[model samples]
Target: MDVVMRIEQTLDGALSEAEGAGAPPGLAAAMRHAVFPGGARIRPRLCLAVARACGAEDFSAAAATAASIELLHCASLVHDDLPCFDDAPVRRGKPSVHRAFGEPLAVLAGDALIVLAFETLARHAAACPERLATLLLCVGRSVGMPFGIVAGQAWESEPRVDLARYHRAKTGALFAAATVGGAAAAGVESAPWRCLGEKIGEAFQVADDIRDVAGDPDELGKPVGRDAALGRMSAARELGIDGALDRLDLLIGEAAESIPRCPGAAELRALIRLEAQRFLPKELVRVAA
Candidate 1:
């Protein structure tokens, strides 16, 4: 199957599983609402990309890993748009889960999706049981305490914040999971892939910060200027837009340098360059203009 098709199939199946066995109909619907019409599906795409770069032969396992990463990302977005956080009422160019389904259903939907992510991984363990532990570890560490997306959200409530740590946890953790988990799914040493994910994650955070400051909501398909309004730490706020852009460029360079010596290193680097272009709001705006 094509990459996009595989991902969509896995996601659809996983969501269906959540709706089974007397699951609440409204909650299931809200979960489906949060996941479908996904924006870019970048984390899963990166996961699959890294899996292929690492020469994944277990395509099923790789697909499961990629889909799980995307689920976690979608779950994060559902929670992030709750009334308590960044609550502007739109997501993926549509009413957010909370806005459309009510906050309680939205919460249930997010929780269900988080559980579903792990379930997807466990269900696919038969494809490559040996790597299952590592995959679970990667996913767990990316969403749990101390240094996951949970920690990233927790940072917002702190009296003082470490911006690098904040960004790493908030955005970079899952990217790290994608790269590392992808390699592990392929039965490769995940260590070499870690820095690439870290760099890419950080670069993404910088790009997102830039977009939050300067992007059009219509173009971005979501509200902009959120970081400032929420009084959150932002690369654009601290470094200035030009500096943040420069930093994003630098991070992509470093991410390219971090790619392991694999069969498709050169091609992967080229792909990274192409993905990097997608992150630049200025360039995107200029083209749109």
Candidate 2:
């Protein structure tokens, strides 16, 4: 199977297990609705890429870690699209979870997905106790209060906030987790590799910020101007369009440069390059033409 198919299959299995015997009616379907209609699966793919670079002895563990991260990401999205947050009516080109399944179900589905992420990770750890513990610790730190996506969302409510810190916590945290979790799965715990993950995470956030401003809703499958509309701090708000693009370029370069120190750095580098192109300003492309 192709990498995407393999990852999707893994995710599907985990989701199924999460909805076991007594799962509330419609809940499983709602959760599946929020998750599977196909996304780029970039975060999990990145995790696998990093693991391959590290020469992971057990690809299954690495793949499990990747799926776990994606589950957590989906959970975050369900919550983010709720009326209390972005209030977005659509997601991935469909009605938001709350819109499709009612607010209560949507809330439960998000909560379930979060629990599912940990469960998936724990299942992977059964084979490698030490590595599993390390992965849990890293994933916990990246998703927990004061430093994870939760913290990132909390930033929106705070009266005073730092834009970079917000971006790092909200979006960069998962990217960091993906890299670190992959490394842990591979049993490779080196300082340089960890730093590579950090850089890539930050770059991913920067690119996301750029896309918020430059990307079309049809393409992104979610509301675009919500960041500005909600008065939330964003790279575009602080740096402006041109400046955000420049920052994205710098971040991508840094991410790519860090790859040389990683075992499977070349593939990671190529992936980063391809993703970077996605964020390039259309004007820049037109200028080159």
Candidate 3:
């Protein structure tokens, strides 16, 4: 199967396992809502891509790893859109989980998805027991932590914050997990893949900062101008739009260069360039000298 098809199938299967089970119908439905109609699916795609670039022989384990990363991502989005966080009304051009269901259910749904992510990975662990521990560590550290999305969110509550660290944990952790987990799932050394993931994650964060300042909400499928409204630190806010744009381009270039030598290195580089072109603001690209 193709990457997209495999990803969607694995995701659907994972979520379906919850439906009409002993769980409450409403909770099950809410979990489905948060997962379906996913956005770019970039994290999972990158996971599978890295696995392939490393010549993953166990396709099932790789697919599970991809699905697990995507589920954590979806759970994060569900929580991020809550009243306590971004509190946005729309996500992926539709009402957020809290808006569609209630906040209580939304919270449960996110929590359930987090658990489900681990469960999905566990089911495929036997395929490569030697590497399962590494995969679990990568995913766990990305979700929790002194250096994970949870820490990233907590930083907002602190009086002082390290912008780069905050951005990396908040947004970059999972990206790192995706790449690292992909390699680890294939029983390959993952350290070489770390730089690529971190750079890509940072570039994606900067692009998000730019979009929040100047992007159209309709085009973005979510509210824009949130950084300033929330008084959050952002590249666009701290560095100015033009400067952030420059930083984004720099990160994207760095990300491409950071790819480790692999069988499909050229193809992966091209994919990164294509995604950059697709995601980067055309206005920013046009304005750069």
Candidate 4:
């Protein structure tokens, strides 16, 4: 199956299991709403790419890991849009989960998605618990405390924060998990792959910062100027528009270069270069530059 199809199928199947008999209809519907029609599906796709680059032909592990990461990402979004957080009213051009399902269910849906991420991984990894263990740890560190996306979110609560740490935890963590989890799925030693994912995550954050400042609400499908509104640190706020753009370019190059002597190293670099183009769309490039 194609990468996108593989991801969607896995996610659909996971949701099916989640919505089975005796499941709460409201929670199931809310969870399904959060996942379907996903944005870009970049994290999951990144998981697949890293696995393929590591020479994985059997994509079951990779696909499961991809689905897991995407689920966690969706969960994060659900919670992030709650009134307690960004309180975003819209997502992917639709009502935010809290708005569509109400705040209580929105919180539950996010929690359900988080549980489902691990469940999806476990369901697929019954035959390879050893590899699953590594994937679980990698996935855990991506979203959990201290250095995960959770920590990234928590950084906002602190009176003071470091930009690099905040960016790494909040935005870069999952990207690192995607890369490292992909490697683990393929049975590759996953540690060396961290730098590539970190760079990509950092680059993606910079791109998002740029969008928050210059992107249209219709195009972005959510609020802009959120960093300033929420008193959050951001690349656009730290570096000037020109400087942020330059930093993005440098990070993309570094990400491409950080490929860890894999069999598909050249192809992976090409992929990074291609994604870099998508990150800063042509119009944005013109506007921001």
Candidate 5:
């Protein structure tokens, strides 16, 4: 099967665990809202890509690892859009979880996805039991305290923020986990692949910063000017559009170069180049033309 089909099928299988009887109907619906019809499925796609590059023999474990990474990402987005957070009204061009289901359900949905992500991983760990511990540890480090996205979000609440640390934790952490989890699932050394993920993650954030200032919201499937509105640190706000674009270009190049040598190295580089299009945003594309 194609990678997209594989990722979607695994994700569907993961969510099915929540759809059965005895689960809260509202919460299960909310979780489905948070995940279904995803945006690019990029993180999970990255996970599977790295697994392919590393010659994964354990398809079930790799697919589960990828799906778990994406579930974690979906959970973060649901929480990030909460009224207490971004208060984003729409996501993927539809009412956000909080807006559609109410704050209580939104919170529960996000929390549920987090638990479900780990559960999905654990269930599939038996497929590649030898790599199970590392897979769990790698994914765990991308979500929890001190060194994960949770810590990344915590930075936003601090009295002072280091932009570099903030960006790495909030965004790069999960991307690193995607790459690392992919490697571990494939029974490969995962550490060296981290730099590629970090660079790509930072590049993605920079791209978002630029689009927040320059792109169309309907096209973006969310609001624009949010960074400036919230007084958040933004590449476009701090560096100007031209500078942010330059920075994004630099990071994308670095991400491509950072790929560790492997049989699928060339294809991964090509994938990075293709994914970079998502970063460029349509508004900028018109400008460049």
Candidate 6:
């Protein structure tokens, strides 16, 4: 199967497992709703890409990690779109989870999906315990306190916050998890690879900042201009569009350079380079230049 199909099948199977057994009646459906019609599946694809670059013998473990990362991502979105946060009316071109399922159910659905992420990883741990543990830690750190998505959300309420810190937690954390977790799953333990993850993560956030300012709602599948409208700090706001784009290019180059000295590194570098185009309109690219 193709990359998209392979990712969809893997995620679908995991969602099915999450739906089965003793889950509350509507909970499974709600969780499924949050995940399907997945956006780009970039994080999971990154996970798989890193795994491949690391010479993984079996893709199953990395696939599981990818699915788990996607689940956590879905859960984060469900929460982020709630009235408490972005209060977004639509996601992936559909009604937000809270709008479709009601607030309480939406909250439960997000919670359930998070649990499912950990469970999915646990099920695959037997084959690669150390890697599994590393992935779990990386994901948990990226989703939980201090420097995770949760911290990202918390930053919105703080009286003072750093733009870099907020972007790293809110956006870069997961990208970091995706790359590092993928490497761990492939049994590759190298500091340079880990640095590559961080660089890519930062670049991903810069790209997102650009998208929030210049991307169309139809293209982004969510509200644009919300960041500036809310007075949220962003790279575009701090550095101007051209400056932010330059920063993104620099970070992407850093990410590409950090790839290990190995046979497949060139392909991995190419993938990292493509990430610079995310949510960037062709016209905007010209205007920003």
* Number of backbone collisions per candidate: 0, 1, 0, 0, 0, 0
Q: Taking the tens digit of each residue's C-alpha lDDT, what string does model 4 give over 1-289?
A: 8899999999999999999999989999999999988898999999999999999978999999999999999999999899988889999889999999999999999999999999999999976778988899999999998799889888878888887898899889999999999999999899999999999999999999888888888877787888899877788888978899899988988888889988898998888788776776467553221
TM-score for all models, in order of appearance: 0.96, 0.92, 0.95, 0.96, 0.96, 0.93
Candidate 5 clashing pairs? none
The CA lDDT of each predicted structure is: 0.88, 0.80, 0.88, 0.90, 0.89, 0.83
Better of 2 and 4 by TM-score: 4
Over the stretch 4-49, how does candidate 3's per-residue lDDT look in tens digits? 9999999999998877458798899899999888888999999998
Note the residue pairs that clash in candidate 3: none
For every candidate in turn, the CA RMSD to the true structure comes to 2.3, 2.3, 1.8, 1.9, 1.8, 2.2
Residue 108, candidate 6: C-alpha displacement in angstroms: 0.6
Model 2 clash pairs? 53-264
Two-way lDDT contest, 1 vs 5, winner? 5
Model 4: number of clashes? 0
Candidate 1 per-residue C-alpha lDDT over 137-242 given as tens digits, one digit per residue, 9 for 90 to 100:
9999998898999999999888989878988999999999999998999898897888999999998988898999888889888988887877777889999988
Q: Candidate 2 regions off by >4 Å?
A: 279-289
Give the candidate order by descending lDDT: 4, 5, 1, 3, 6, 2
**Which candidate achieves the best lDDT against the true structure?**
4
Q: How do the residues 1-289 of candidate 5 rate in per-residue lDDT, one tens digit apiece?
A: 8999999998898899978889889999999999998998888989999999988876788899899999999999999999998999999999999999999999999999999999998898776778878888889988888878999999999999988998899999899998888888888899998998899899889988998899889888989989889998898888999998888878888888899988899999988877887776765742221
**lDDT comparing candidate 4 with the true structure:** 0.90
**CA displacement after TM-score superposition, residue 148 of candidate 2 (Å):** 0.6
Model 2: how far is 65 from its true place, Å?
0.7
In candidate 6, which residue pairs get closer than 3 Å at backbone N, Cα or C atoms, i.e. clash? none
Query: Which 10-residue window in model 4 sums to the lowest lDDT?
Result: 280-289
> After aligning candidate 3 to the native by TM-score, how far in Å is the CA of 101 from where it should be?
0.8
Q: How many backbone clashes does candidate 2 have?
A: 1
